[model samples]
Target: MDICHEAPVKCLAYSPDGKWLATGSEDCTIILWDSEGQLVQEWVAHAGEVWSIAFSPDSRHLASVGFRREHAVWNVMPGQGAPKAMILEGHTGLVVSCAWSPDGTLIAAGSGDKTVLLWDARTFQLLHRLNLFTLEQHAHAVTHITFSSDGIRILSASSDGTVKIWDAFSGALILSLEGHTCGVNKACFSPCGKYIASASSDQTVWLWSIDDGSCVETLFEHRADVRHVAFSPDGMTLSSGACDGTVAIRHIRDIILVQDTDM
Candidate 1:
């Protein structure tokens, strides 16, 4: 099935239930596609390019951020006609990324101002601003934000060439994972929560051990900036996408097995 957007798609996401795929575009609109590739719904979601979109854990809602400097949460469940959005405004700069917690209780937004804003999903309240502009914090725009599987930790990728993990509840900086020579575009924890995979503009994907905070493996298969990285639901496979127009899938079960054996 083929679908078209008026402008380039800036971000895309799949519902947790496997029912819908959402695409946000530079045209300032969002389109929801059913599993069959039929358009489920379409609406303008932001005043400018929509940088990111993420579905709630239950697939009942979607949180989006963009060049508009604010994040909007939309009720995307079936039968909700052009649902009203709860706008979260606190960022002093354009919002670049947003993610929903696995439990659906929180939303984290990262911005050009180099801070991650944590919001309560239920009340749509701004709970914490995760950066204080200290020397150790992100020196550049935050490129991505994600919550760990248990929702106890949050990760933020920055153009400063680092990924930082934070305590989700108290907004405390836990660990800083650094090594990328260029900006990190995205990062996410493995399903088992033992590792983190980060993609970078250096054209590499790095797998890091969370407990020891060390680079366990580095893959240099991409010829251009690596834009995204994710682990399979079962955590046996790793996938990465790059600006070179390719998706790379690697079997990571062996890597985990090797680590377990060494331990």
Candidate 2:
């Protein structure tokens, strides 16, 4: 077994190349380890628990967020050398999630304030703030966010039981997918951009068509609230981590169609 962390590991991710393992904790630290699970380095980035983390597709940069109100980045070193990593700032509320655009040109983060902030990958400057409407749309905290394969749209899930698609460049709302009876905790587009999967507190995962936002299937596999979901790089497998602490893998072939003519 691998000794992954010294505290409760909140979120974890593998580098695009599958060479590095990045783990975040509530102890205000982010640890980087090799594929073998041996710690290479750790950095303190926030005042409270580090809630989420994401690796740039290149595997050279890391973006981390925490509850105590801060966000940071690190230059991941492969072996024994030290790196002079840089920390970025600018969220007043606790940062809930972070992700890198496909080409790694932009970093997008969601927070408790019900907004998503976009940042320049190189300069680390705030590029835009995506504010979700309340009276007309989402009225609760934005729990998570993801970028589509082409990086032209942003997929945001919220505590309002809905996921909204936004134009990445203009921040204009495009589509909203709603079907889960409870709040959606996380949502991500399939690697091929053909499908979208969302994890919810309703104890189910919903798969929707990317083009029409139509419900494709409802995966009621997990016995408890689903906490997270990820599409394997090949887009053929789906993995979900639940509040029950079980990571369940669902193959794309198993997502049943709601209708015989469903695309």
TM-score for all predictions?
0.69, 0.72
lDDT (Cα, tens digit) per residue for candidate 1, span 1-263: 23557765556666777677777777788888776667888999888878788889898899998785968999996675686799998999878788886678989887778788899999988899988443347899777777677768878899999999998778878999999999998898887899999999999999999988899999987877877676756777676656554556677888899987876
- What is the lDDT, from 0 to 100, of the residue 242 in candidate 1? 64
Model 2, 1-263: lDDT tens digits are 23434555566666777666666665677777675557778777678877788889899988887786677877787565665556666677867888888789988887777777888999989899888544235788677777777879878898999999988777788999988889998898876677888989998989888778899878877877877777656666666656554555566765533332455
Instruction: Give the residue spans of candidate 2 off by over 4 A.
Output: 1-14, 18-47, 81-85, 112-135, 167-174, 253-262
Angstrom error of the Cα, residue 29, model 2: value is: 5.6
Q: For candidate 2, what is the TM-score?
A: 0.72
**Measured by C-alpha RMSD in angstroms, how accurate is candidate 2?**
4.5
Please report how far candidate 1 places residue 117 from its true position, in Å.
5.3
Q: How many residue pairs clash in each candidate?
A: 0, 1
